[model samples]
Target: KIKEEINKRIKEKIKGILPGLLEEEIEKITSAKEEELKKGVERIIEDYQPLKEENKIITKLFRLLGDKTAYAAEKKPVEKTKIEIEIEWIELFNPYEVPCEVEGWQIKTSLGTRALGGIISSDSYRFIFNMVIRMPGKSIGKEILGDNGDTVILTNKRRNIVDKVSYRGYGLPWSAWEKNDPRSREFASILPGGSPGFRNWFWMPEVGEAKNKNDYSSFYVKDKPFANTGEIVFIHSGEWRTIRLEQGGEWQILDKITVADPPEKPVQGRININTASKQVLEALPGIDSALSQAIINYGNSKKRPFNEIGEILQILLLARLGSNGKDDDKDGYTDEEDEREAIFRGLSNLITTRSNCFTVISRGEVVKNDEIVAERKIKAVIDRGSSPIKIKYYRELSED
Candidate 1:
């Protein structure tokens, strides 16, 4: 009777404490939350016969512990940013296909992103934007917002979603992409330090905003802003129209394009390769009448002829063996496009497609009462056909 009573008490104790113990054990083993733990506990009890002493409830319970525990807290998933800044209504555009309507909308991008453009690489160049920016209601020169990792937002009085652009350049690089619907580009394919914003490529102001160019010219002029350098008239061999400067900055037809080299001397003499006849070509040192005719014929043959002086040299080199009928690129341009395109047009050297000025030098003696007193001469590009016959320069010459 004593053994029977003891066994009965033990059984009662196991039944009473075992449920609570199982709950605690399951909770510890599985990092599951309250709901998931409850479900798991019910499953274990239903599948294993807990009341039978001979059953492998303990063994099965141990096996359940090995079924991947979920004791650690769950990490929340990151969601995409839902801002209304990207616009994609237009069919085709630049950089990003769609343009943003930023009239009242204020931007929040790095200051470095405002204006950026230059030689993107040795092989190609990129042009962006150049602006003297001002905020509404702000003073002319007053400074405003836009630093790295700053939030760029556009909102009206109601705080309604107008538009927004945000970037994090405190770390890697990214590209500013415009699409109809936006999605974060996978970083796996992006290069380190890649920036994807208009104004935040390198975040150093050097890479420039996706919109600004440093204003380089293949052949630049003097006493003028970089903008004044005129366009080169590239005559296509096959077409009868001039190719735009926007079309041949890469010079796919010309093997190696050269820029405004070493800056033309301020008072330097420039010969228009396009209009210069055979005689004028002979006037330039190292050029003969044969090369001059070649230049003229090359220009006359194309619709938009000789947009670049480099093209002139290039064609001269190609025609060295004298017209082999070897049309490499099949684009009609055989040589120089004149002075319109400089590989830095307005930075230093000056060449032009048009010649409104002519430098004339008249050698004569300044005589005093018939005896030659002094020798004098002047070199200046005459401002020809103006209201007055303008003599461009006047100076004393050494008459020895």
Candidate 2:
């Protein structure tokens, strides 16, 4: 019986070992199949990589070509949305003997309705600003006068009436019209009418039915007061058409329109004396043609050629005394003396002499200073003359 039990135990062990051996063989076969499948997938991907790269390159090339073609297509040039006009005027003031260049002056437009008048009289045309208008493109039509005596009209290639509206000159302090004025109200009712909009007229792409009628009474001016100074230009059909006085006066169209460029500003290190023409002299403060000529004459008479601009003060004093300093006691100065001194004092800080030298007085000391304050050295001098003189010596220093 014992021998039979041992044989039975050995048979049970053999059965368990056979099952484990079969499981190991199955696992080996599964692993080999998985490796073969991975290799096959990698081979497929490697074979198509060049074709994918080629496709990407072709797509980029086509995109670039399409961009170039679109860029070359023709298109109409866009019209300018706004127009610019430069105005020039000769302003005059009272005491006609004073000189035209010395008068208060400015440049303006004609379409805007405002009046900048001081004293209204036939003789005291206290200020007359002779104006000239400048435009960029071709002129279509220009009207010197309009139904409203002061209004002027200008047009572009399309011949659209630029100044179809009218403005009243409200004299003196209240020199501009009210927004509720019949003309202003009517203009505001129209498509485009009010302050700056009035200058643009009703000629905008967004404007539809309102473009037909020429009347602009439905439009209203802005309630704001007129600007003390500025320009008003009329833009229509993508072109600059007309200019009006937006501030300081009635809309007086300037007929002397020209195409020349504006003058260049004066250079530094140079002195522009009042001796130049009306245009040149106007640049100086309180200088008019008469006064400018006077200044020129005084400059010429000085044999020393103005070592410094302060010499002008002395010259003006001399000129006021009829070219003699003898009247020093008449209070003892002439009207010319007072006028010259006043003018020099007004411009003492701004004006420079051709010699590029200036004088400065600190208390009782005469100090000579140079152009470059950074390297300036202080020195003192004394003079026993009636007028205490202070001199500052300076030269144009190198900018290292």
lDDT of 1 by residue, 68-116 (tens): 1111111122112111111111111122212333333232244422222
lDDT for model 1 comes to 0.33
| Model 1 error, position 105 (Å) | 28
Whole-model lDDT, model 2 = 0.30
Give a tens-digit lDDT track for model 2, residues 1-400.
1112222322232222223334454344334334433443343223223223323322111121111010111112312111111111112223223323311222224634223323323213221211111122322123232223243332323444323334444332221222221112222222211122121122111111122356332222345532211112221322222222222212232212211233132223334353234455544444555666666677677644545444454443323423444432232233322222333323333344432234433332234573433343333343222134433343333334
Q: Estimated TM-score per prediction?
A: 0.23, 0.21
Those runs of model 2 whose alpha carbons end farther than 4 Å from true positions after fitting are: 1-271, 274-294, 316-340, 355-400
Ten-residue segment with the worst summed lDDT in candidate 2?
65-74
